[model samples]
Target: MSSAHYDCTLSLTDFCSKETERVCKLICLITSTGTEMLSPTGFVVLSVALGFIMTFGFVNNFVVLLLFCKFKTLRTPVNMLLLNISISDMLVCVFGTTLSFASSIKGRWLLGRIGCSWYGFVNSCFGIVSLISLVILSYDRYSTLTVCNNNRWPDYRKPLVAVCCSWVYSLIWTVPPLLGWSSYDLEGAGTSCSVSWKVRTAQSHAYIICLFIFCLVHYAASDICM
Candidate 1:
């Protein structure tokens, strides 16, 4: 059999497995897929709820993008970075809302491997870029405060560079998990391929320390600017 990121493993406990699947099936029944026992009432409630989520995401993201684009003065480096970040988040909503709402109602991933791969890939790319943008936003603030800011002529090129580099870095970290370089596990509803180093034991302590050291440099720089 081919290796896959997701597999049907017997749940860690018998009761847990039964209860979880039971709940899932019940949810499906109440919404779109399974036999709806309560007739049209359950169907209506589910549709309304799903619609609310999709609508909210769509409207909110659109407003953010519109406001950012409409106002030119908010085009400062940091604001510009934020504008792109919002665009990424909005893409998360736009590309996904309808399909996600459908899946939630129907209780299955209709998006097959092609869809999953693209969803997984794009989300990973955007998530990292958003986070890195946040981190860089802080750094940019520090740079401005420290009087070492990149010129305000707004090279415009640098932000694009950062965005491109952010996507590249995100892909580098994300692709490996699906490719089976490491064990990927789900912590909750969202898929997380993030490999975090913990300092629980001697072997893992070194990696944790290195992470802290790097963070320390950034923190110290921020303080100096402050």
Candidate 2:
């Protein structure tokens, strides 16, 4: 090749390299300053909303638990499922909602990467547990009604088994993301994290589809059928 052509090629490559580096830096700056995505008023509104949820959820669930503990009659099999739902929701308020509330007040995720993962996993676990518990509770109530109509006593052992199964079923769905079936990342104005639903890979898509079908669709169908 001619010297002029060789020199021109080197200059072009250098220019492209510099441009790429500059672009990378710009991208990093934008990502690192994610808190700016929301306005001050937006943060305040989010904080107030989350604060109300945290306060009311904790208080109401705690009241239910207190009543459960204080009274012997509330310990029936059907109410046992209610107790499970309350426990999951109360824990979600404690382990999940509190962190989101704090981050909303600060206008950013304070826990960093590991904390984000923890937040996502814990919330998903408890949330799914509550959902499955509700489904079981519905079925239990329906069964109770049928049994009452037939003048038969409901089996006590089934509700206990159902409660255990709900937790196990929740773990089955929520734990796969931690193991790389998908991931947990900051979502929605960078204030919180959950399942990486926006990911476009086959693995992520499969996980989301399965979760939707098994958890969400199942919940909906159960409620409708009941």
Candidate 2: C-alpha RMSD to true structure equals 7.2
Q: What is the C-alpha RMSD of each candidate to the true structure, in Å?
A: 9.5, 7.2
The estimated TM-scores of all candidates read 0.56, 0.82
For residues 1-226, write the lDDT of model 2, one tens digit per residue: 3222222223344434765665444444445443235778998999999899999999999999999999988888789889999999999999988999999988878999999999999999999999888888888778767765553665579888988999999999999989989999888767888998777899999999999999999798988899
Model 1, CA-based lDDT:
0.55
Please name the candidate that would achieve the greatest lDDT relative to the true structure.
Answer: 2
What lDDT would each prediction earn against the true structure? Answer: 0.55, 0.84
- 1-226 in candidate 1: lDDT tens per residue? 5332221243424323765776545544433321234334554565567578668866886887788779888776667677767777777666654554564455445666456555555655566667766766777777677776465587677777777776676566556546644322221122211232322455345433543454344445654555
Instruction: Report clash pairs, candidate 1.
Output: none
Task: In model 2, state the lDDT of residue 133.
Answer: 88
